[model samples]
Target: MPVPATGRLQWTDVPTPLRARLEDALDAPVTDTNTPAGGFGHQLAAALTLRGGRRVFVKAAPDADPLTAANVHEAAVLQALPPGAPAPSLLGVHRASRWTAVVIAHLDGPHPDLSPASTDAEQTWALLDKLTSSPAPAPYRAAVSATPSTAASLHGWAELAADPPADLPAAARDRLQQLAELETAWPALACGDRIVHGDLRADNMVRDHHHGVTFVDWAHATTGPACIDAASLAPQLVLAGHTPEDVADLLRDHPATATSPETTTAFLTALTGHWHRNARKPAPPGAPGLRAYQHRAAAAGLALLSHRLS
Candidate 1:
């Protein structure tokens, strides 16, 4: 299935003052703007062609928006990445008139399709191998900790089991108590020394022809088990039309996901529960498509978990 597009702010929708500041930061006049599709969608994300034909990607948010802090964090993460990391280079960060924007050198490519047998999957997995083997940079390790963050964000099965929702599937509801217990295992299982792109779905990656796969959106980056990022690829593979059994087998065979069987099942359960709970909430402002996307992802995740547990 195609990733949903979270409706975003257009270039024309930006205030004139902020636009001028952005252009000044680029040191050029913007000649064209193209908004990319399929992200969390609470900011201004565009591919810009400048006066000298330089192309760059930019994401801007109001100073008051949560995305503003995310962009700031992402800028810091990008700056700290080692030269060989498969991510974009941060060009500059600009802020003015209650808005913040980060500029990045653009990589040309489409988001990878992770269906079984696709070359995109091969390239993406190769990229993950490189990413997971490298230790987090010193500066990044000092700033962000993955354990507490994962513990805080990856809770849902326990909460859901406490008060099961009306829409909860029979597969999960039947095994709710078991799942609630299992979901608690990821924080320990995810503990490691490698850099983890906490969110590693297709939409968060671009398959550059020359670069293999280039990761984007670093707000969730942290140091943890390489398998944390590697395991994230399973549900996305299911979403791309692979069977749950196949995805499970692939994860087992992948070097990065060398954890025990219990660890893999626990992480998948926690991830499914996270999306299952979030998918029921009201859509955030400017991201009407997010809930639907989450709902689909939750279903895909649940399917994989069901197979694993079975």
Candidate 2:
């Protein structure tokens, strides 16, 4: 959650030509629209209510915006999702003039809160369990150009060991040497064959009476160990008030993380470095609270890693 708050485009911001095109794709006139907010950064997302009373979700962004590529990729990924995957269906995409808009089945649900025992938590666990059961589809396996990975960038402890940040947590600074060595094994430990969501957190998930559980935003989908996404969710749950141990106890039965103790430790260790670095830098545009959130996430990760390391 950013502090200045994510600034969203209005439903009116959809160019007249684009809106008309979306109307044609849906075979109905757009009567009204509502903006939906969840992610840390803003993209143009809206629930369009058609004149015929059908509702669909659409996301649009200009080529100039970084999210346009992701929007297009998400549409393609959703279209090819495996059977029974808990996600929205792509209806169609309207691409013109370096602007792109993707329309999909509207999913109604509240974002998950990682609170222990919360219904959101229960639903999200189920969603992860279901998703992890499937591998990345053919398109993902045959991707022509790999998206630049943040995995390589998560090794901040190496830099911190070389030049410790003034705000570095005392616990981390005390064990900088051990952290430096632990991080070296991270990239190697991360190797796996299962498709990973890469980014798994409350904002990327939703649950409703109808759909049961749904995960949105497939931009970070990748071929990795099944354990990666579930393990990634661990720190977020801790940040949401679950103790690290509690999360571990809960995830014990998950096939993904069920046998990957060292892998989980390495991933959390790298994330500790990831957030530790980002939290100390200038906040990115349109995301004022991101740095603070990263710091908190780093702390949660450190708590988890400490237990494993001990």
Candidate 3:
């Protein structure tokens, strides 16, 4: 039921006119193309050698229609970012027909393993802190407030307790039920209007020799509780084999991340529960890796909850 992690779209997939616009934006003929080394999206970073041997990264998405506005918003957000922020520079935005392409200065660096040594944890926290602290633009804040939370996300643990995947362990199923019951006790926490990179997994970050870290994939950017972003990071941390001590260390050093442990456990439990439910469905995108990561997070959440209940 799980799908393989499909890589990014190819340059050949671009329409003829869109390609021309891209070439015009760069003022260079695309000498060669290199597949971007990450997740499924309509994004590509090609190594383009211009007529004069200048190189830049060219990225193309679609124009402002209902389907493509997210890309436009991403470009706008990147453009508005404070100078000296580690993010890439937005070179230009061009529109042709239904397609829109945003060009950024090519970053040369190594992709650091998401799970770096403890020495690198400070840098990681700093990057997350900067991102979480940035003010959300008015339009982005409005859009996130308007978009409703996914039904599955809102009631994930309840749904899982009613009918869990056959593959999930009995202990995991029991934890789901407990989490569902616990959800009733907490008030619906208001997120207020904080800016968050809705998805900030390890694969989305690239570390430059000079610039430190630059996060890519702004498509999932949204305005929400800072905790949700912290919650999102937990799964990745667990998958990387971080211990409870590691998590505690992160929270200890970064007080803003120190949400109530019970609340964080419940939130992460629901997230993993949702992933498990989706993984069992037929032809689910990212089901394989999603299921794997869900199990890891579920295990970590159960451990935390056990400590809280004791």
Candidate 4:
């Protein structure tokens, strides 16, 4: 399933004054703009080509909201990235009464497909393999782990066991008690010292023609279990229309994830619950399609679990 850019802001939506300011921060005149797709819930996402033939990726949000801090966090982390980091370089940042934007060197690549047996899948798996070998830089290590707070976001099964949603699947609704029990152990299981991309998925990554694989969206960067990021690939592969069995085969060569079935199941349960819960909520300011995406993601998580548990 393709993630939509349904509600994210377009380059044309930016006010003229603010656009001029961004160009000023870049110390270059903006010559063209392209809104990159795969905007899960980002408020602003686009690539601005500079007068000097440079292209920079930009992500921004309305200055008054929760995402305001996240956009700033990305800029800080991007700027502080250590040598040999797998991410792009931060070029500049801008904040005003209306919004905040962070600019980084644009990665010229195509988004990797998560579907099984494709070249994109192989490339993505290979990239995750490489990420498992590289330790998070000192700056990334200091950044918070997304697992604990993310764990707090899981409310579906518990809420359903008490007050079920009308659209909840019969299988899921019937297994609420099991889900509630299984969900409790994920946070402890996810704890570790490596930097997990925390939000690993095809959308947050790209395969560069030259660099091979490059990651975007650093706001979720954190230190956690070495396999945490790799563990996420299975569910995402399912979402990309692969079966859970195919995902299992994909994991055979993935040591970071293959070594622990218990941990993976726990991770999948917690993540499924998170998406299931959030999907039922009101859409955020700029993410109309997010709930729909979450619903699909939750289904994938659930499917992956069924196969793994069987």
- Using lDDT as the measure, the top candidate is 1
Model 2 scores worst on lDDT over the 10 consecutive residues at 1-10
Instruction: Residues 8-50, candidate 2: write the lDDT tens digits.
Output: 7656766778777777878899898887666666667888899
The TM-scores, one per candidate, come to 0.91, 0.90, 0.79, 0.86
Q: Write the per-residue lDDT of candidate 4 for residues 204-304, one digit (tens) a residue.
A: 88777777677788776666666667767778888888877888666654867777767767777878888888888888655667889899888887777
Instruction: Identify the superior model by TM-score, candidate 3 or candidate 4.
Output: 4
lDDT accuracy of residue 140 in candidate 3: 54
Quality of model 3 by C-alpha lDDT: 0.59
Task: Tell me the spans in candidate 1 whose CA falls farther than 4 Å from its real position.
Answer: 1-6, 143-152, 188-190
Candidate structures ordered by TM-score, highest first: 1, 2, 4, 3
Ranking by lDDT: 1, 2, 4, 3
Clashing pairs in 3: 62-100, 63-100
Best prediction by TM-score:
1
- Please give the distance, in angstroms, between residue 145's alpha carbon in candidate 3 and its true position after superposition: 6.2
The sequence of per-residue lDDT tens digits that candidate 3 reaches over residues 1-310 is 1122454445776677888888877777777776656543434546556677676666664443332565566676667655555578778877776776677677767665556454444576676777667566665565555444432144356677776667666556656657777654333642435666656666666776777777765656665555556666655665666765666456534534575555555555556556556555554343235445545556665554454444
Residue-level error in angstroms, candidate 4, position 244: 0.8
- Runs off by more than 4 Å, candidate 2: 1-6, 137-140, 143-148, 251-253
lDDT of 1 by residue, 108-223 (tens): 89888787768887777777788877677787776564224552258688888989999899998999999888888666776667877778889898877788778998878777
